[model samples]
Target chain A: MMQQTSDKKWFDELVVELRLRQVHGSAIGDTVASARELLRDTGQPAEEAFGPARDYAAALEFPAAPGHDWVRQALWPSLLGLLAFLLFNQAVTAWTQQELLLVSPAQLALLATPVVLVALLPLYLDAVVRRLWVGIAIAAICAVAGVLSAVVAPTQPSDAWLAIDPSPWLIGTALVMVVLSVRNTVRSSRAADDDEIIDPLSGTTAGTGAGARILVHVTNWLFPVLALAMLGLALALR
Target chain B: MSTSTPDVRATDGVDWPSDWLRATLGFLALRALSGGPSYGYAIISELERHGFGAIKGGTLYPLLTRYEAAGLLTTEWRAGDGGPGRKYFALTEQGRAELTRLSADWRRFVASSVHYLDPERPEKEISP
Candidate 1:
């Protein structure tokens, strides 16, 4: 007797195996199996039966974590704290100088402090594994900002661009933000699961998931663009 | 390839265990497909029928997948014709050749052992 079997039977079997493993979100193995059976009955190969199954598995196994969300969470609060600290310091300094409270670039940065600080709130909850690279970048930026503030702080008021001098206290605050940001980001990245192959420290593809694309998107576009905007704002006001 | 060479005991007189058990399983799997393509459960039951009940699902399933990947076995999906789904596996020409060679090795080993250890004794010379 010829034993004719349909391809759908084999596809159903594969579906059951994948379900037994609990591969993805809550999947009904029997239902998936039945669907596979239907496909096979139509004269499809086993490969055809499994295409959707593979995609569903990939999505569950690798969830994306956007870089902007991570950076904002970690750095926002710290930025606000620094701004508040700077503004308060400026207010006291201006009072001692007997000058009217005015919006200097430093004072404007001080006013923006709360926004920066609130932004840091998100960083607190982030896994250290996720923020190491962003932290490093922030640290580098702060160090450079500190050096510029210290060297260029003007002793006398002048209309010339070179007359401005950044206070040492302001420079010191930037350095502190840099150090804290680097520390938190590194700690968070290392604490995350090893399965996440992207190194949070450098925002680069370490190995696993869709890490390569996320890293490229973050490093080549997001952070650089934000950093450029920040520089432009500071230069324009100065 | 070096390990699979035909030398056997001819190699420096080393007494290799020869992994005979695994070879036997592979040989049986190949022969089991000669009747028709079968699935995991069918293969396990066939092995059980041959008095090799130690073969379990965990061992057989991985082995089947590995064999399919190695090109010694080919599988096709069969749907709804049976009550549920199943992946039916068939032996390839390479597997058939391997089974023939392994069967020959088993025969040679058995014949040599029986002839050396339990050679036929005359009825009158048999000890009580």
Candidate 2:
């Protein structure tokens, strides 16, 4: 049982390391399966057979996708979606209350905190993935910023830095979020998306089951669903 | 070019320095594959049987992966009998050629080193 757990952790680390290196999923799957094969054959523990996962991943030096390809395809879209979602959150309450969306400088800055942190993720992404504390810290920062942004929101126009009509902003941001979600869904559903790990022998993807499909759809539609929830909360509060 | 004893055995009781193994494991691995396509454990076993200390999968797989990327090797998955499939790695033509060249160079270097270390060998006449 202890050996199985250790091997499981090693394999998880190996997958993460490979992903960080931008290795293709097919190649990652092949590496994993091959490593498992050796372990099964020798009955040696994963660490003993493969050394460290990070070192093993580096040594493979598999041909990676273009460095900025993920940035262009995934990061930018998610960033845009996040920005849209934040804007929608801000505008929803104001629209529901039939008031202009009043923004204080402090509130805007606080609101921008999560977006900025997420935008800069490529820099510390490995640290965030590898270290539990780093990931927790980032999440806490984003969550605190979200709560503080609400607290710092202007209660009246006199206390605001800017007041703008909320309806157009609300609709625009919602549209942006929905469109981006649709785009993500389409991209994920495409066969050309090589993100799914495939079994080398069977040439079949690992997580193509119904549950996996639902999870993928949920992820793709996450922003839109969150926006709807926020809208419902705004109406209820009003 | 000698197919006999394709497995290179280390001298008895003297472990080759890791630096030496690290330097030569690449072509040595290619030479191991030169016999035919082999899987991970098989390759490691061949090396270990020939008295190369156990080459970890971490060490061997990466080298093989790089070789595959460089077109020096190609891999195929073959189903095991009542077990998981095995990834078999075979040398390409380029890999074969590289192995031959590296083997020749290594032999020459070893011969020269041996001759230089022989105590009875006469020193060459110096022009100066």
Candidate 3:
């Protein structure tokens, strides 16, 4: 049991390393299955049979998908959704209070913090995924920036740099979020098979269960769902 | 009870220089697959039984992957007999031809090396 757990962790690391290299899902699956086959035959621990997961992943030469494919497919849409979600959050409370939405330069800059961090993710994504501390540090920075943005928001229109009726902004941001979520959902369900890692022995993808489907759905709708929660909280507080 | 050599390192009884093994493992692997389709562990065992040192999967799989990409070897994943599926590698025609060529060249090289190293040969033949 202990060996199995460690081997599972090793395999998980291998998968992540391969993903970082942008190997196709089917090729990743085949690499994983073959490695597992050797381990079973030799009765050797995974790390012993294969060297470090990262090095092993680098050693295998598989045809990777185009390098910037994810940028077009996933990153841009997610970033846009994030922008819309932030706009919705800012507008929700003002609409709830039946007041104008106030925007200050400092507030705008602060709100852009997470968006900028996310945009720069592809640059250091491997380090962020490989090192736990990097991920935690980024999350901490985003959280601090989020709290500071709320604190700096103007209470009165006179104190704000720009003020406008909150109704259109609220409606527009919500529409954007919903549309992006729908598009993401459709794309994911269609592309899931192409991106899934299959276990050759079991004749199944890594996760084909109800739980996995639910997780994918939740991921597809995350931004909109969070926006709705923020709206409810603003209404309740008002 | 046995005497140990002063400069010898312990190994799995057959410890050829690592460089030599690294250089020849490609053709050796091709030769292994020449008999029939074989999985990774079987290929390693075949090489070890023939007096080559144990080859780690870490070292062997990458070479196999390269050959597969180069069209020298083809692979198939088949269900095992009451066990997990196995990925078997077989030599392509190109791989067999490569093995044949490498083996003949290696034999000729070995023969020349043996002739040059023979103590009974005249000094003038190697004077240069």
Candidate 4:
């Protein structure tokens, strides 16, 4: 435990330095890589970098930003789960055309409330706050689902697999549960050891022209928007 | 082989530093640099901002010198925005590639770990 704490402290300290903009932008890669190299060279077991694992998941929720590191890894899966719920809700509503059976806009907003709130909050808050936010979000989903299920139960048609309108609340809750479960698994993995660093000795770049670099940056920002627009067009045309 | 005494292996079961530490250090440095370029002091300060205050001058200075020597990082001497001239360090392409590789590995590690720890569905398990 002591060793783990120290490792976390060590990594945390490095992050602090980086956040202050002290490290030269060009050397950032090497500084991080070298520190990691030193640790391995010194024979310490690498800590796990768990947060980046969920980057794909989070990208589902928000536009991707470079170098946010763990935020994407941690919140992404949750965001994806929420997105699935939203999509599923839309599908069910479009299919059933029942306002009560599906989630109302208010409920959808409520469902998103916890995650967006947690996300928008300043990072300076306590870790405990983050944990609680996650927990409360899960609980809220379940509660909303339960209420929806009860309300929808009596309205089911005889041939329907579900007796009532499929409650958007219930579906959303289930989705939240799925996301939370994933997050728990992620959290347990490698024990959130703050000590873990990524690869070192990997500082090579393609060194394209300045124009190319700007183009790359601009394209990164635009790719998601273009994709989203395309998706919207497809949905509208469908 | 010259004149130094031969090193002996430790009989005690204490674990020495491993490659993980070195990789972690390098990853952190790269992440820091992604923000902007800086000299030693600026890098140190940046580390502090990221919640890594324990990295003092003793550990940081030698590491910077070594990185410069390896050409993984390049330094240009520049007058300070406010004060004296300082050596600025930036990532070479080789260094940036290293960061990408490390980041991917880190993500993989996290995913595998999560897979092991919570393999079951949430509805299946109830916590007290």
Best by DockQ: 2
* DockQ, every prediction: 0.03, 0.86, 0.63, 0.02
Error of model 2, residue A76, in angstroms: 1.3
Q: List the residue pairs that clash in candidate 3.
A: none
Stretch of 10 with least lDDT, candidate 1 chain A: A194-203
User: For model 3, how big is the CA root-mean-square deviation?
Assistant: 4.9
Error of 2 at A117 (Å): 0.7
TM-score (C-alpha, index-matched) for candidate 3: 0.92
lDDT of 2 at A79: 93
- TM-score, B chain alone, candidates in order: 0.69, 0.85, 0.87, 0.64
Of the two candidates 1 and 3, the one with more favorable DockQ, higher being better, is 3
lDDT of 3 by residue, B1-128 (tens): 11233454444668889999998999888888887899999998877767678898998999999999999999999998887889999999998888899999999998999999999999999977
Residue range B1-128, candidate 1, lDDT tens digits: 00122432232223324365455777677766767687655665565555455343334544555676577888765653435556677888887777688778988998987765665746554456
Sorted on TM-score, best first, the list reads 2, 3, 1, 4
Query: Sort by lDDT, best first: what order?
Result: 2, 3, 4, 1
Local accuracy of candidate 2 as per-residue lDDT tens digits, A1-238: 9999999999999999999999999988898899999999899999999888998888887878997889999998999999999999999999998999999999999989988998899999999999999999999999999999999999999999999999999999989988998998898889867887877888888878999989999999999999999999989989
Off by over 4 Å in 2: B1-14, B122-128
Question: What value does DockQ give for candidate 3?
Answer: 0.63
Provide the clashing-pair count of each candidate structure. Answer: 42, 0, 0, 85
